[model samples]
Each structure stands twice: as structure tokens, then as C-alpha cells.
Target: MDLIAPVVLTRPAGRNAPLAAALRAAGLAVVEAPALKIERLAVAPPVLQVGDLCVFVSRQAVDACFDGRCAATPWPDGVRAAAVGAATAQALRLHVPADAILAPAEGAPPDSESLLAVIEAVGLVPGRAHIMRAQQGRDWLARQLQARGWSVYCHALYRRSPAIWDRDTCAILAGPGRCTLLLTSLEAVDAVADSLRRQAMDWPATLKLVTLHERIARRLQCIYADRPADALTVRLSAPDEAALFQAILASARSA
Candidate 1:
């Protein structure tokens, strides 16, 4: 039988447990090397009033928004919460009613474009909209909302810094063993590339990457352009955990 490669999960710190557990249960060796460390910013959560639309850019945004004082207050009735992806939507459910949350259809690419479609379908008259997000990120969604006549307000709830890999983790990545790296965001792709450069390590010919979006895959392709065409492989998967699991498993088996 062909040997399966170890999977390296590069999500933010504290966010890899569930996926790592799932992969391990399926008999795959897992490495948790967070590409980004999330730091909650000292920002007050926006007040939700009726007819207001609150958008969360990521699950971390949702968590930071409702961490303290925000948790004590109930989500106002008639206020709609929007999530850029299913995971973010799930997080929002803890603070808002399920019905009050808007998200893309099942299996649709979990992205700002997808969420914008869902928001448009509801024909929500352009009104006050608040976006809870990190210190820096793509402003596509906010720009789109503003173009639609929505009074968009942005709240920075957290900041992301590149994580430093430990010696053991660095050894694994630089070792000869087959490995598959999972990247979920454009920032993560850059973080991983930066980390590898810092170690003066080249992309292992046997290494494969699985990313959640075409844009991220393209970014990876650009970053590793100096490597031989066949030295690195990039695959795209849906944002959901199940899809990511299958993509990682397939990449491992392909080795």
C-alpha cells in the first residue's frame, strides 16, 4: 500500500483541534502549525438595533465580537446577522437566532461574493450595516455594500500576526516525509511562505497544498513559481470541514 502523507493544518491558533481530531480519527498523522495567531483588539462591539445588518467576516470575528459586554446583551429583534461562510454563520448562531442569520446556500463557495448574493436575494433595502473583522483584510464586501447605498460601518475586533513554528514543527516540514499543507485564507498562504523563507527552506518536491479558494491557490502558485512545475501541487476545496477533510485525505493519498 502507498504511504499516506502527514497533514499539516495551518489555521489560526486554537482553531485546528476539531479538524485535527477528525483526521487523526481517520488514521492520518496530523501536525498543528498555526500560520496565524489571532489577537482580540480592544474594540467595543457594535450595538445592534432593529433593521440593522451585522456582518461577520470570519468565525474569529464572531467570537471577538461577542466575547464580553456584547454577550450580556440580547441580539435585538429584527436585526439580521450575516456571515461570509458557514463556519462564521454557525458561530453567529450562538449570539443570534438561526433564522435571523443570512448565509450562502449549502455547498456554495463560502466567500464574500457568495454572501453578497444571499444578501441581495433578500432584497434588503440598503440600510445601516456593520462589519466585524480583523485589523486588515479584503474590503471587497464592504465596498460592494457601500455601492449598494448601504451605510457600512467597519469594526476591527482582532489582529492577526504570523505564528512562529517550533523546531519540531520546522523539522517535520523540512524533513523528507510526504506532507500536505492546508491553507484557508490568502493571509495564511503568505504566512506559510514567509515562515519557509525565514528558515531558508525550499518547497519540498513531495509536498502538496490544499486551499479553500481559487484565489488562495493562485497566490500559492505565484509564491512557489521558482520551484519546478511538478515540485508543488495546489488543490482547491470548499470551505466546509467535510470538504477540507476529503481534500486533505486525497492529497495525502496522491503522494
Candidate 2:
């Protein structure tokens, strides 16, 4: 099958390389541009009271929690942690005492939605939630909790910024090719889209797009709807490598 869009993955920095390798193995070209970066915050963990809630958005956030930056302060007594995914919760096995974690059902939703379900299931009031997350991410959970008069404090565990686009990647995004592109994060899409627009992209409308969810996919469609029908959208079920690989294979096989 012809290579679909040069797949651009928007997973965290750590997962990008693996996804790229998988795409290549599936006989597809990949553009490794991280949508978000997981930067460890060099700060002392908050002094937890007797009981507090620990919240994490990704596995990276869980990694940051135990990475010495938050070492001085351990999880507060009776602080059960809630994570966005099972993968993320499992990653905390070492640092957080086992059974102190719970994640939403697999494939239910991403961070905020999962968090809300967890909070409701546990029947815990949103009191003193120490959200450990990468820098400049979605505030959906916080906003919802705050609306209900709950206390939310960011541990500010990490941050993700656009990586410098290399020469070859830039060329492909702007040049004419029968390639498809995958955009997992909205930030990554906006970043590359703007860059192409800056250079007056003459790219073919035949390019395909693989997005993680419908929201971002719709936004992108509106941005390029005037183009050819071949320039289309395929949604990945999750941000995990397996799902992404499945997306690449499917896009490549599509007529």
C-alpha cells in the first residue's frame, strides 16, 4: 500500500520514538513531533495534611511525582490517588503504596473525563486535590472542581512545548506528496498548520489526517474542507502506540 500521510504523532516525548518505530514497521513514514513535553518540576512536594487527594493526568505525571522533585513530601495520609488511565496508575506501583491508585475504565475517556468519573465513584469531595501535571495543559478537571467549590492546587509536575521542527519534516508538510498526517494534540496541529501557512504551503489536498478524537478532527476538517476529498480524517481510539499503529495501517490501506 502507498504510504498514507507522513504520520505525525502527538504523544508525549518519551512515547514518540516507539510510535515512530511502530509506524515504520507498518511500512509508513512518521514525523516525530511531540504535542506535549513532560518536564519534571524541580520543587519540593507540598506538605500534605492527614488526608488529601492525589491526581495525575498521565504516566509522565506519575513519573514526575516520585522523581525526587516531589520526594521530600510523601503522599499525605489517607490520600488515595486517581489517575487518567490504567497505564498511568500502574506506573505508580513503586512510589505510591499499592492499591492506593484507581483509574477510569480503559477507553472511557482522557484525563478530565476519567478524573470526574473516578471522583464520583470514590464518593470523595474535591478537597485539597494536588494535581500533578505537565505545564500548560488542559484545566477541565480543575475548572469543574472549582465550579463546585473544591480546593485544587497544581503540583505543576511537568510541561510540554513544541519541539524544533527539523528540515526534512518541514519539507514534507509543505511539499506535494501522497502522504497522510496524524495530529494527536491540538497544539501540535496549530503549530504545524501555522508553520505551513507561514511558508504558503502548496501541499496537495489529497493528504489524510489521523486524529485521536473527534473534536480536534472536526477543527482540522473545517480548516481544510475546501480541499480534496482524499484529505480526510481517521480517529484513533487511544493515544497508545498500538492504537496509533492501527491508525497508520488503516489509513495506508484506505483507497
Candidate 3:
């Protein structure tokens, strides 16, 4: 494997280890620059019933929901488990049966729109639903479900706080050599931008971005609008490890 460029991973703490190790094994220099820290909130175990829908928005949600407080409780027999993306679905499999998990088809964008389509295709009757997520996030899924006559309840299991990067990490990001930053959420985009601005640094001309979704890519474009067209390069990838790996390699090759 050829060393392309340093890859900056900005996932919350403890979440970047797997990807970082994989990138390192591929011979790419990996930088652990977590842009957000996940703080699990204390919440009572969700009360689920038969014929109800249970949705997880992220892996963190799955971890938080299945934490020690609720780990011993078995999933209700008839309740359905759904995830926003394949990665979340994978995480969910640890606690639920694979057959019981509902998610977008492999390779489809792992987002609210896609997940909503899948849910509708299953022809599940409008009933009660629980959306497990952070303190704040996009409510498109919940609203969509409500519009379809489903009673939706949002459970906040955690919160995302911006992680402060040290001077050395910022230097690596702002340095001259080509660098590819993998951004998985809009919050991460803001977190990175805020960190760079706080250091009085501008977005590096050599920086390349690989975003998990188009919404996040658009957010980055808005934030870096001042940069010339040629200076900004962004690629979109499905929210899965395989897709992200390929996108990162493509960005490196383009550089």
C-alpha cells in the first residue's frame, strides 16, 4: 500500500480507534483529531411494547441504550429495531437479531430519507415509535413518522460536546502536505471550523474532505464559501467503512 497523505479522523473519542487502526495498516498516516466528545446521559430504560418501532440514530445511541442500566433487559419480542444506516444497523446487531433489524439497502446513503423509504416499504402500520438519539439532532425522521400517523417519542441518550484540539494537532491539519479529513456529521464540520478559527488559522488550500452525506458536504461548502472553487475539494461517501475507505483513497489519488 502506498502512503497517500495523513488522514484526519474527527469522530468522537473512542470512536476513531477502529478506523485509525485500519488506515494505519493500509500505510496511511493517521491523525486522531476528535472534533466532538460523546457524553452519555443518564436516562431510564425505554419502555417498549409489542408492535412498536424502536429506531437508533447512531452507534452511540445503540451503546447508550444498551448500557449497563438496560443491558440485561431483553428486547421485546414483537418490537421492531431499525437504524439510520448500515453502520448503526451493524452496531444494533450486537443486541438484536439481524432479521429484526431494518435499514436502507447496502450502498444507499445512510440517512433519514433512505431509512424512511425502507420503513415505508415494509408497510408497517402506523403505531408507536421511539427514536434514540443525542440531546439535539435533525428531527426529519420523527416528523416524517408522525406525518404518517405514527406516535413518535424521542429519547435523548447522550450529548455531543466539541473537543478541543491541541496546537500540535492543529499544526498537522494546517500544514502544507495534502490532508484528507473525514467528516461524518454537520456538528463535526462546525467543530473543526470553530477550532481552526479559534487558532487564527484559515482552511488549508491542500485540505481535502470526504463527507458521509451530502448534507454535511453542503454545510462544509457554506462554511468555506470564501475559498476559491479550486481550493475546495469534497467527496461524498455512504456512511459505511467500505465506502469511506474507498472515498479516502480516491481523494488521496486525486491529490
TM-score of every candidate relative to the true structure: 0.92, 0.82, 0.93
Per-residue lDDT for 163-183 in model 2, tens only?
Answer: 555556666664545566777
lDDT of 3 at 63: 92
Clashing pairs in 2: 4-180, 5-179, 5-180, 37-160, 134-158, 135-158, 135-159
lDDT by residue (81-185, candidate 3, tens digit) is: 999998899999999988888999988888999999999999999899999999999999999999999999999999998887766777786665678898899
Kindly list the per-residue Cα lDDT of model 1 for residues 139-162, writing each as its tens digit.
Answer: 999999999999999999999988
Q: List the global CA lDDT of all models.
A: 0.84, 0.69, 0.85
- lDDT score for residue 11 of model 1: 94
The candidate with the higher lDDT, 2 or 3, is 3
Between candidates 1 and 3, which one is better according to TM-score? 3
Off by over 4 Å in 2: 35-38, 69-77, 174-177, 202-204
How many clashes does each candidate structure show, in the order listed?
A: 0, 7, 0
Q: Compared to the true structure, candidate 1 yields what TM-score?
A: 0.92
lDDT of 2 at 148: 70
Model 2 global lDDT (CA atoms, 0 to 1): 0.69
